[model samples]
Target: MKNNRNRQVVLKSRPADIPQAHDFEIVESDVPDLLDGQILVQNVFLSVEPAMRGWVSNVANYSEPVRIGEVMRSFAAGEVLQSSHSDFKPGDKVMGMFGWQEFAVVGPAAVTRKVQEDDLPLSLSLGVTGLNGITAYFGLLDIGRPRPGDTVVVSTAAGAVGSAAGQIAKLSGCRTVGIAGGSAKVAQCRELFGYDEAYDYKSDNLDLALGKACPRGIDLYFDNTGGVISDTVLRHLAVGARVVICGTASFPTWDPWPNGPRAERHLLVKRARMEGFVIFDYASRYEEAVSRLSQWIRDGRLRYSEDIQNGIECAPAAIAGLYRGENTGKRLIRIR
Candidate 1:
């Protein structure tokens, strides 16, 4: 067995704005023994997402906030070291809310699913093949309801979820345009993700760029950033256009409620539909999305990127970096 000592990152303080390293504290403790229906997992990789800021903040969100002095909540990929449950045994690979810890003792509820794609890397269970890809799959297909020959525009188009959604739209026979930050990510949106057109949201005249790229208007808008980018896309909606609000990465604080242009006028004029998408709503159908996503990877119809940082200590800093648009793909922390 590995050493009994477990190192964990816990919430030290809630950030006033973007989460910083000072917001978390790393502490060492003894790994607890597993009880009946519990499994001991040795965490290998930890996910760093923009949503994590909400998880740690005092602000209300869809999920309960991670309490102070508790291990910071996170999705982690790891191997079961021991199991008191019949369904899981030693050496079984799994992914779940294992928190920001070196070792986790959890029940079945905390275990999202057993990692079954043996040919794929375990780290992927936290990235493309996991929530990121699944979110894109259902949000675009089910919510956006993309049709052939439609013009789809994706905000944060080079991001983990955005990239997947864009490629999936292309696979559905829609013309895809990507909006990302910086020249590199715009280039990545075009070259790597195969977007028909990509614009740097920072440098380009967004209104004119969107007008030119989506000449016929946007049939589907997979919105990951819900600020100015979305404000711009809403103006370009085609008749009956569908908008999927996946994330609001641009908002530093939702406390005072940052003011923005209302979208009702645009939706009403175009008779469009805009709906929020939460991945947890489709938890029952995760396998369905994963199965198709896996096949897409096998068929070369899908591709993904990962920005992996070494060491569990990097987990806290990674969240802040993600909001800064520092990562090109799914950002993960490899526990060393």
Candidate 2:
């Protein structure tokens, strides 16, 4: 009977600045009986993303915060074990916001899209060919609009979304420059993803590195860590540049309004446009992006990395690890 129990993580408290283990509680309960129109899923991989920080915070954001005492919101890829839904059957693979749990009983609305077995690992559905890929594809191409010879700079370049965005920009004929937090990530951006240039924002001189790497100035800035790193990048924007504000990793809290150098004058002088992106905005077209991302991988034009933690017990600290920059690529918790 213990084997039939479902283990899950729930939010104990909304985080003040950064999430800690105490903020989450792992609970085990009897697996609920399947309901009409519901499918039972045995979650395999749970995604840990930066956006989770905002989801658990009290700060205003694009989406509603994960209410306290609810199962922590997360994206997961899993296999169907039982189904009352017409389309899903036992053994079918699926991906969706299945939360941080070993098993979930959900309806069709909870499943984002059905996944097919392919040469790529199913975990890729949570990273390169999933949300990260879709986010990078539309966020960079549709918003940043990089052109041939354009200097495209991506902050947090070693991260899942940032790495994919940089690679896509490179494939589009743009000169890609990645800004990462450490020497290891910088090396990864350059060696693994083939960024034209990569810099360790922690160790490298910000001004000097930008000057050397972007001699013509940045034509497209994919700003992920939108604190000091983005502030410095703004100083190098080319005329008519497009800045895609994909994330704000460095800012711990937005409620108090962290102060930094304003980009108003810079934007005006450079005649550039800056915009924010939410992956859900492009939800209807995720399949299209995933197909192309898959093709890119098959043709060897794209690559991805995953840092998998092997237990549901890791859920509490998984997102904290992301907040600390402990993850090199996509962070996933393997909870089979």
- Give the best candidate by TM-score: 1
Best by lDDT: 1
Give per-residue lDDT, candidate 2, residue 51: 89
Off by over 4 Å in 2: 1-3
- Candidate 2 lDDT score at position 322: 92
Off by over 4 Å in 1: 1-3
Candidate 2 local lDDT, 1-336, one digit each (tens): 225998889999878888888999999889888889999999999999888998888888888998888889999999999999899999999999999888898999999999973688999999999999899999999999889989999998989999999999989999999999888898999999999889988888988989988888999999888988998999999999999989888988897998989999999999999999899989899888988999999999999989999998888998888988899789999985
Write down the worst ten-residue block by lDDT for model 1.
Answer: 1-10
Instruction: Write candidate 1's Cα lDDT for 1-336 as tens digits.
Output: 345799999999978888899899999998888888999999999999888988977888999988888899999999999999999999999999999999999999999899999988888888889999999999999999999999999999999999999999999999999999999999999999999999998899999999988888999999999999899889999999999999998899999999989999999999999999789999999999999998899898999899999998798788889988999789999999
C-alpha TM-score for every candidate: 0.98, 0.98
Q: Report the Cα lDDT for candidate 2.
A: 0.91
What lDDT score goes with residue 18 in model 2? 80
Worst 10 residues of 2 by lDDT: 1-10
